[model samples]
Target: MMGNRALLMNFMEKFLETVRFGNNDFAVIAGYGDVVI
Candidate 1:
């Protein structure tokens, strides 16, 4: 469970980075992701 949680956090960081520095479309997805989280 701890491993899974760590992996998820890592993925979230990378995805959030993409939203911040990559593209606008991903920001929309990341916004929804934030709501879910």
Candidate 2:
């Protein structure tokens, strides 16, 4: 049951919460790809 968009939104919400809690940092590295700064 859940739609793909709903699932994605849920995931994003969790990810943002994690970042907001200061568990990790968000960054984009060149060639190496995304890095959790």
Candidate 3:
């Protein structure tokens, strides 16, 4: 059970990182919206 919990935590951390990266990419695009349009 402990090992499974550790694995789940590791997966959660990676998922969070991916989510953060996606948010940063979205913010960058929104910031440049005026020029993009």
Candidate 4:
């Protein structure tokens, strides 16, 4: 399992990429699912 900060950091990185690519659906689905982009 990951720590809180690590999880938050990971989410932040992915969030940025999501914004860059405009993949809002991916961002929402990725919250608890392990779907690779």
Best candidate, TM-score: 4
lDDT of 3 by residue, 2-35 (tens): 9767766665565566567777665555445523
Candidate 1 C-alpha lDDT tens digits along 1-35: 99767767766776778777868687667655764
| lDDT digits (tens) for residues 1-37 of candidate 4 | 4676677778778777786898888877785463342
How much lDDT does each candidate structure score? Answer: 0.71, 0.49, 0.58, 0.70
Better of 3 and 4 by TM-score: 4
Q: Which scores higher on TM-score, 2 or 3?
A: 3
Colliding pairs, model 1: none
| Candidate 3: residue pairs that collide | none
Reference-based TM-score, model 3: 0.57
Q: Please write out the lDDT profile of model 2 over residues 1-37, one tens digit for every residue.
A: 4775676566576667666766654411221232221
Q: Rank the candidates by lDDT, best first.
A: 1, 4, 3, 2
Error of 1 at 13 (Å): 0.2
lDDT of 1 at 37: 67
Backbone clashes counted, model 1: 0
Backbone clashes in each candidate structure, one number apiece? 0, 0, 0, 0
Worst 10 residues of 1 by lDDT: 27-36
Question: Clashing residue pairs in candidate 2, if any?
Answer: none
